[model samples]
Target: MAPTESNKRLALAIIDFLGSSLKDGTLTADDAESIEIAQSCIADTFKVDPTDEAAVKEAVGGQSLASIYSVYEKLRSKSTPQAGSASTEQSQTDKPKTGAPTAESDKFKSEGNALMSRKDYNGAIAQYTKALEIAPGNPIYLSNRAAAFSASSQHEKAAEDAELAVSVDSKYSKAWSRLGLARFDMGDYHAAKEAYEKGIEAEGNGGSDAMKRGLETSSRKIEEASRGTEPPSEELDSAPGASRGGGGMPDLSALAGMLGGGGGGGGMPDLGSMMSNPMFANMAQNLMGNPDMLNNLMGNPRLRQMAENFGQGGGMPDMSSLMSDPNIADMARNMMGGGAGGAGGAGQGGQGGQGQ
Candidate 1:
C-alpha cells in the first residue's frame, strides 16, 4: 500500500528529530554505523537519497528539530491504529473533519517563538496554548511554551511545561535542561541540581553544557541558602548587554530591552534575539570561571555604585551617564574582553537559578 498520511507524519516527525539531533552534536554517536539505519530509513520514507542534506531540510519544512521520538513514543504507548472501515473512510471523505489538529499547530508554534523573540511573552504563551490545544502533549510545543514561560519569569508554570516535555520523551536532552532551569528558578535548588545532573548525563558536554554549569550554580545556591545568606552578585550581570540569572549574574536579554539600543527600525529592542551574540556568552563564561575577577574589576570607585544598583534590582544606571567616567568606561570595555573562564555554551538552559 502507498504510505498513508499517518505514516508520512510519523516519518516526518522522526526525521525532524533525528536529523537535527545528529547534526547538532546533541546526539553524537562514537561510530556512524549506529545511526545508519535511522538515516537510511528517514531518506527512504521521504523518497530522498540518504546523502542529500538539502533534500532532508526541504522535506522537514526547514524547521528546527525538537524531539524525534516524542510524538511517536506516545502513539506507541497510547493506542494502536485501527484500520478504517470502507464506510467510515467514505463518510470521512464526504464530511471533512473540523478542528483536527495538524500542521497548523506547527505554525502556531512558530508564531509563539516569534513573539518570544520580540519579548511579547504573554502573546507567546497564548500562541503556545493554541498549539497545545491541537497537539496536546507534543514535547516540542511543551518545551517551546516552557521557554516563553521562563522568559516571562513564571518559573512555576515553566517548570510544569518542561516537566511534561521530559515525561513525553525521557531522552530529550533539551527538555531536561529546561526542567533543570525551571526548578532552579523556583528555589528548589536540590531538585534543580538533580535535574541538571540527569541532563548532563543524557545530552553530554556538547549540547547541554548549560546543565553542568547549572549544577554548579545550584550547588552554590544550596550552600548559601542553608546559611541564610543571599548568594553573591553575578559577574555576568554587570557587563554591557549583560542579563541576570538568579542573582548568580545578570543575563540582561530582558534588560537589553530596557536599555537603550536602536536598530535601523524603531521597534522595541529584540532583547531575546540579540542575546545570541558570542559577546554575551563569553562575558558570562569569564565571570563564572574566575568569580574573583568581578570583585577586582568592580573595585574601581566608578563601578561600585552601579554594581550595587544591579545587586539591589534598582533600575539600571543610565548608560551615557555611567560611561561619562571614561576610566570606568575603559574598565568596562576591558572587562568584556577579559579572561575566558571557559564558561560558555550553557545557553538559556542555565538561566534559572532561584532569583535572589
Candidate 2:
C-alpha cells in the first residue's frame, strides 16, 4: 500500500534529524538504528550509508536535510504539469548573495585597534580613517582616530578630531580626555580644565583618576598665571649649561637622563649630595630673591612642594622680615653695587647671625 502524507512527513523529519546528527558528529548507535528503521518505511528517504565514507560523501554531498526539504517544499507547492506537455525540470540555486558593507567596516576597525596596541599610530590612523569613510559619523571610529593623532603629536588635529568625536557622542570620556590634553598643550588651560570636568561629570564617580589629577594641575597653573606675576617665558636656562635662561623649554634627553638612563639603574639622584652642593644653595637663594621666579619653577607640583619644605626648615631666614629691615636691605643693595648681595658683605653691616 502507498504511504500516507503524514507517513512521508514523518520520514522526512527522521531523515533531517539523522542528517544533522551525522554532520555534527553526534550520531549515537540508537539514533543510527532509528534512522534505518525510519528509512525502511519509505522507499527513498535517504540514500547515504551510515558507515561507508565514500557512499555518505556521494549521497550527502555537503547538503543539509533542511536545504533539501526547502527545495522539496517549493516543488510540492507547484501545480502538476499537464499530460503530453513538454518535459519540465526545476533548477535549484543556493548561492549566498553579498550582504551590506558592515562586515568590511568592522574588519577595518579591528585592524586599527590591533595597530594601536602595537604603537603604530600612523597605521592605526589610516585604518580608522578607512573605517570612518565606510561608515561616517561612527563615534568609536572618530575617537580612536583622535587617540592615534594625539599619540603622533598632532595635537591640533587631535583636538579637532576629539571635538568631532564628542559632538557625535557626548558620553565618550576618552575623547574628552584627549581634547583636554590637546587644549592644555595649546595653552588653553581653562578650556582644558572645563573639558576634563565635563568628562568627569558625564562619567560619574568612576571617572579616571588621571583625568582628575590633570584637571587639578592645569587649574593650579591657570591660577598661578593669573596672580600678576611675570609673563610666561620659553627659556630653558635654569639647568647647568642651558642657554635660554628662565624659559621653560623642555629638553627631552636631559629629562631622560634625570629620569635615569635606559639601563634603569637607581635612576634617582643622591639628594644628600644635591643638598650639600653650593650650586644648589645658590639656586635656592636665587629662587627666594625673586618671588616671581617661583611661578615658573614651581610648575611641577612635587618640585614646588619640595622647595616649600626646604624653605620651612629651621635656620632659614624669614624672607618677609629680611625684606622689611631697611638697614639690612640698604647694606645688601650697596654691597653688590645696588644689587641684593649676600647676607654680610663689604658695604657692611655687622654680621647679624649664622641664621641670617
Best by TM-score: 1
- Estimate the overall C-alpha local distance difference test score of candidate 2: 0.58
Each candidate's TM vs. the true structure? 0.38, 0.37
Q: Every model's Cα RMSD, please?
A: 27.0, 25.8
- Report every candidate's CA lDDT: 0.62, 0.58
Error at 115, model 1, angstroms: 0.4
lDDT by residue (tens digit), candidate 1, 1-356: 77765555556556556655677787767635666677677758656453556654444433333532344455344333247844345554553232234678878988998998899999999998888765667778888889899999999999888877776666677887888889988989998887777677668655455767888999999888877775666554454423346755643333343333334124433544445667755654555554444444434444556645644666557889977764545444544763232122121112211111
Candidate 2 — which residues are off by over 4 angstroms?
A: 1-101, 227-356
State the lDDT of candidate 2 residue by residue for 1-356, as single tens digits: 76665554444555555657766778776677766666554436433334444433334333344544543443334224445644234322321111123677779989999999999999999998887665565667777888888888888888877776665556778878888888888789998898888678667886789889879978997998887487667765455322223353333233223323234334334544443667644544544444333333223333333334443542334566654655445443432334455333312333222124
